[model samples]
Target: MTTNLILTNSLDEIAEFVTLLVIFIIVIGITYFSIRIVGNIQKEKLGRGNIQILETQKVSNTKYIQIVRIGKKCFAIAICKDSISYLCEVDEGDLQFNTDSSISKSSAESFKTIIDKFKKDKPED
Candidate 1:
């Protein structure tokens, strides 16, 4: 009966090893899927970011001009490591930006009407 007991013990050990390996594989699969989900979430956010960079032009080495759209208006900004400055506000009629169909934008009004309103609202010096 000693040989019979030894055979039973070997089978039990093999079963335990198989169970542990299956558990390890499941853990690795869960980790990989979770990482993929997180990456997709971050990509979606950047794709629909509110502050859109329409164009950029690099001048010199570090100095660069960026045309950015903030809400309904667009502005040009000068970016550098030490300081950042707003150069001017670009009229929306001047440049057109290509956007994804997923993003919703408001209807555009006539540029002539916008200019007339700006001149009327200006305060005399």
Candidate 2:
């Protein structure tokens, strides 16, 4: 009967949809795990080296100032797109390190608060 044919067609379509969804989810999970594994491996390799970037500040689109630690010594360097120049040797005692984990959250909250204040003070059209 046509009724049975319609029911069978819908079931087949549903099964195909479910199969595709499952495949998509599996692919996403595999990609996520692979990325995480690669990242961990890279971090481990980088941490084993004596040269480490302690901090970096962007000066321009193609320029930056970076504080780097080479073994027991720390230096400030200017990095341009084409070259790197040594600025000066930084005294470790004068440098401040942020130990706060909620800095990003606090900064986001402050930005949101500023936006809300701006909106409140705006003139109505």
Measured by TM-score, the strongest candidate is 2
RMSD of 2: 9.0
Which pairs of residues have clashing backbones in candidate 1? none
The TM-score of predicted model 2 comes to 0.75
Residue 124 C-alpha lDDT in model 2? 100
Model 1 Cα shift for residue 42 (angstroms):
1.7
**Residue-by-residue lDDT tens digits, candidate 2, 1-125:** 99999999999999999999999999999999999899789768987999877777779999988888899999999999999999999998988877563232333345667779999999999
CA error at residue 90 for candidate 2, angstroms: 1.8
lDDT for 52 in candidate 1 is 70
Clashes of each: 0, 0
TM-score of 1: 0.46
Could you say which candidate leads in lDDT?
A: 2
